[model samples]
Structure formats: C-alpha cells, structure tokens
Target: METLVKLFKNNIRQYGMIIALVVIMILFEMITGGLLLKPINITNLILQNSYILVLAIGMVLVIITGHIDLSVGSIAAFVGAVAAIMMVDLHWHPVVAVIASLVVGALIGAWQGFWVAYVKIPAFIVTLAGMLLFRGLTMIVLKGQSIAPFPNGFQKISSGFIPDFGSAGTNIVAVLAGILFTVIYIVNELRDRRAQKKYNFEVVSGGLFILKLVVIAAIINAFTFMLAIYAGLPNILILLLVLIIIYSFVMNKTVMGRHIYALGGNEKAADLSGVKTKKVTFWVFVNMGVLAAISGLIFAARLNAATPRAGTNFELDAIAASFIGGASATGGIGTVFGAIIGGLVMGVLNNGMSLIGLGVDWQQGIKGLVLLAAVAFDIYNKKKVTFLK
Candidate 1:
C-alpha cells in the first residue's frame, strides 16, 4: 500500500490532467445524455480542438521557459486576413499566399523576440501591447470586413480529407500508411523502454507498456476508420500530423529541447551554464509566431475564407488549456500531451454543452470554476510537497 501510494504521488503531476480529462468526459457524458461521445460530435470535437492543440504544444515550450505570448490570437487573425487578401483581392496563388503569411509571422516573432530577449522587457507588457497592436493591424488589413470564398484548392486545406482504400484512387495507399505508422509507434516505444532499462532507469511495467500499445492501436484504428467512413483523412490532418511528429521529436530528442528545459528550470543558472538564454527565448517566441501563422492558414483554408475576428479569444483558450494540463503558472513545467488533453477537455465542454442545449452562460461559469480549481490544485500541491520535503 505504501509503495502504491508513493508511485501515485510520483506520477500525480504527469497524470493529473489526464485524470481531469477522464473526469470531465464522464461528467459531461452523463449530463449530456451521451452526446459528448456521439460519433459525429466526437469527430467534431477533434477538429475543433486541433488548432488549439497545435498552439498548446508550442505554448508548452514557451511557458516552460517562463514566458507567455498574448499576441498569437491576434497574429492568427492578421495572418488569415493577409492570406485571404492575397488570394482573393490580389489574385495570388494559394501556395504563394501561404508562404507569404508564414514569413510575415516569423518576422513578427523575431520582432517580439528581440524586444523581450534583448531589450529586457517583461513578457506581459510586450505581449499585451502586441495583442492590441496586432489586433488593430488586422482591422486595417481587412478593412473591418471578412473576406472568403478562397480558391478551391486552398479551401480543401480545411475541408478536404485523405482518400482511403474504399475510394477508387486512394484507399490502399492510406491503409498502408496507417499500418506503417502503427508499426513505427510500437517500435519507438519499445526502443525507448529498452534504452531506459539500459541506463538502469525504472521504466513502466511491460504490462502497462502493452496496455498503452493496445490503447493507441485502438485509437488510431478508430480515428482512421472514421476518416475512411466519410471523405478519408484530411489533407490538413496529414499536415497537422507531420507537424506534431516533428515538434514532438524536436522537443524530446534534441539539444534544443535540452536548452529549453534548462532555461525553464533556472534562467540565471542556465545562462551561467552557457545555454544562450536570450537566443533560446527569442527563438521560442519566433516559433510561437510561426505556429500562429500556420494555425491561421489552416483555419482560413478550412473556412474557404478569412474573417476579421477569426482568432478572438483563442489565446484565452490556449492559455487555459496549458494551465489545466498542469503547467505551472510560475513556469518551468508543461508538456505537449498535457496541453493537447487540456484543449480536448475544453473542446468537449463546448461540444457537450452545445449538444445538450446548455446555455452559453452556464458553460462559461463552469469553465471559470474549473480553471480556478486547477490553479488552486497547483498551489496546494506545491505547498504539500514543500511541507513533505
């Protein structure tokens, strides 16, 4: 019993958000008469949460380093406007428009990064100013109007799905790809476990490992199966998948990842240890900016147009998701998966509430309480650990 308790205590930080996710799913599932997990709604939940999940992954890194970006929502809105104007108003090709928007976003990130990392400005002030400045720029670019009905090819970025085996031209290819992905995932997990064992580190039990594999396989099959059901996997889904994999790799398996953890753990000590603190901080913001641009493009393509208010309140959702996913408000802690789960929880709440006809007011109230509870938990846990030590 004592061993079990210690194990639970050790994993609480990592698994706490997951527990919250399960609890939220169960609660909303019961309240909504099972609408939360209904097939169509479940699919929609994934789609709605996808962008924020992407943002949260990047945000996790930024927060871990003890900073925040408030301008992402505004940047997304502005970039979407730019893409729309370039495609519709200027007759630029969708491809070119995308490239242009991304460059602009990177530049925006660099600009802010310079201010924060070099000029020694507080993140809150810089980002707060950025929020207002970029939002106003979006209005100027969009002329207080929404532009849409983009070229079909661009529209497909958001609305198009991958073709599957059932389709005349694409089913076999997709099936093979899915199988390959499963194999790769299993191999990687087993390899990582072996490495941990080599270093005499305590890996999770093989039983737990197999359980994870089974659960992952089921999830992948279910996901691909749904795409195969209606319009195969989306082109954007593929893009998002590639991005997630790349970012996850960079975060977990690179020197860049090490630097980020070092900075988050202790900025001054990290600087003294030659981690290039300013450069890392600058790059982190730049990365966030690029991600915001990518998010804007995806959203715009999906809508087949651009709206002036495309990303309003998005920053709030992303920030909340990170915090709820177990990121410390004071920084030095967070993870990609945690942020994803956090975003999904919010998505579920929105979808479930909407499906069950819960008023928007109540939904907001519940979310507020949930956020408060999460932060309170963080503080209480910190205090408990300090006392224990």
Candidate 2:
C-alpha cells in the first residue's frame, strides 16, 4: 500500500494529466448531449487534431532540449504553399511535390539551425526571425490567394479511411489491431519489469502493474472500438501512430536520445562529457522542420487548399501541448505519449466547445487559461519537489 502511494505521488504529473483528460472527456460528453464521442465526431476529432499532434511530437523534442521553435506554424504554411504551387500550377505529381516540400523544410531548418547551433544565437531570436521570414514567404508564394482542389491522390492522405474486410458492418481489422496493441503492451511491460529486476532496479508492485495494464488496455480497446464502428481507421491516425512508435523508441532506447536529454539537463556538463551539443541542437531543429513540413502537407491535404492564414497560432497550440503534457520548462523531461494526451486535451476542448456553440473569442480565452494553469502546475510541482528534497 505504501509503495503504491509512493508511486502515485512520484508520478502525479503524468497520471494527473491523464485523469484530467478522462474527466474532461466525460464532462463534455454529458454536456454535449453525447455528441463528443459519437462515431463521426470521434473521426473528426482525429482528423482535426492530426496536424497539431504532429507539431506537438516535434515540439516536445525542442522543449526537451531547452529550446523552442516559434517558426513551425510559419514553416508549415510556407511548405503548404510551396506544395500548392508545385502540385497545382506546375502540374507536378503529388509524390514529387511532397518530397520537394519536405526538402524545403529541411533546408529551412538547416538555415535556422546554423544560426542557433553554430553562430551561437539564442534560439528564441532565431526562431522568432524564422517565424516572420517564413510567413512572409508564404504570402509571397500564395500571392494573397488560396490554392485549392488538390489532386484526388493527395486528398486521400488525410481523408481516407482504412478499408474494412469484414462483412455486416463490422470492422474486424480495427478490433484485431486493438487486441494486438494490448497484448504487445502487456508483453512490453512484463519484459521491462524483468529487465529492471535483473539489473537490481526498483519495480512496481505486481498488483499495481496489473491495474495499470487493465486501465490502459481498456482505454485502447474502447478507442479502437469507437473508430471501428465509425470508419475503421483513418490514414492520418495510422501515420500518427507510426510516428509515435518511432519517436518513443528513439527517446527511450537510443544513444542520441540520451545525449539530447543530457544536453538539456546540463549543456556544459554534457559537452564536457563528449556529447555533441551543437550537432544535437542542429539536428533537432532540422527534425522539427521536417515534421512541420509533414504537418503542413497534412493540413493542406485536409483542406484541399493552401491559404495564407493556414497555420496561424499553430505555434502556440503546439507549445501548449508540449508543456501541458508534463514537459518541464527547464527541459530534460516529458514523453511522447504525454504529448499525445496534451494534444487530445486541447482537441477535445475545441471540439466540445464548438459543439456547445462557443464563439472563437471565448474558445481562445478558455484555451489560454488552460495553458497558463498547466504551466503553473508544472512550476508548483517542481518547487514542491525541491522543497521536499
């Protein structure tokens, strides 16, 4: 019992956010007359937030390195505009346009990264400049016009659903996928426990571990079931899942990932320990740029148009998701899963508020308050831990 209590206390930041998400979801479901999680609405929820979630994944890495990217929104807009020009005006194939856009994003990242990593400029100043520069470029590319009606192939990237193989309106694939995910999760947890025991590291109590597994399994199955009932699965959701798995593996199991954390934790010490801080910083921004480009493409595909104001305020949303997901302001903390939860929290809020007929003005204010509260809670928790120590 004491061990369980200690575990809960230690992980309050992680677990609290999840509990808050569930409570908020339930509250919204009730208030919205059961519209919040309806099949179609659930599908829309994933589609609407997919881009922000992509941004959140990249943003978490940036914040983990004790830096920020104020330019992702602009970069995404710029890339989307470039893609529009290539695909629509130039008549380039969708695949070629996508490749070109991602390349452009990388070059842009390299440009800003050179300043931040090698020139020793503050990331804040560099990214802020990038934000303005890219937004201006987006305007120039679009020439104050919206580019629309993308090729059918491109639209499918964001709007298409997985084909169902089962008859009678049943989505067997989604159900199987959910079961597979749960089994894999349980296996991983047990394996991790064994490894920890082998290395003489502390492990969670068996009962607590089992309870955790059950809760997570239930959530996963429930989510998949909802999607199965609606449209099986979305293509964008599949992309998001793949990215999450890859990034979670990178952060947890790779040497570079450890270096990043160390660099954020103590740059000078990490450098002294032979970590390539400059290279790490450079690559992180480069990676962020690539992700932003992908996000831009996804957003563009969803709308089937590229507009001048496509990514307005996107930076704020991504940043809020990262911080609200339990990322420390000082860096060297946070998880990919946490970032997803944070993005979902914001997504649900936006969706629920819209259903309740809240105006954009009220929505913005409420979101601002939520972001502020999340950061305040993080600060308070950090201080409390320091005091206890």
Instruction: Give per-candidate clash totals.
Output: 6, 0
**Candidate 1 deviant stretches above 4 angstroms:** 1-8, 167-178
* lDDT winner: 2
Q: Global CA lDDT of candidate 2, please?
A: 0.93
User: Which lDDT tens digits does candidate 2 get at residues 258-301?
Assistant: 98899889999999999999999999999999999999999999
Worst 10 residues of 2 by lDDT: 162-171
- Candidate lDDT scores, in order, read 0.81, 0.93
Residue 147 Cα positional deviation in candidate 2, in Å, after optimal superposition: 1.0
Off by over 4 Å in 2: none
Give lDDT tens digits, candidate 1, residues 139-176: 99988988978999888776776654454643555556
| Model 1: residue 256 alpha-carbon error in angstroms | 1.1
Residues forming the 10-long window of minimal summed lDDT in candidate 1:
164-173
**How much is the lDDT of residue 172 in candidate 1?**
57
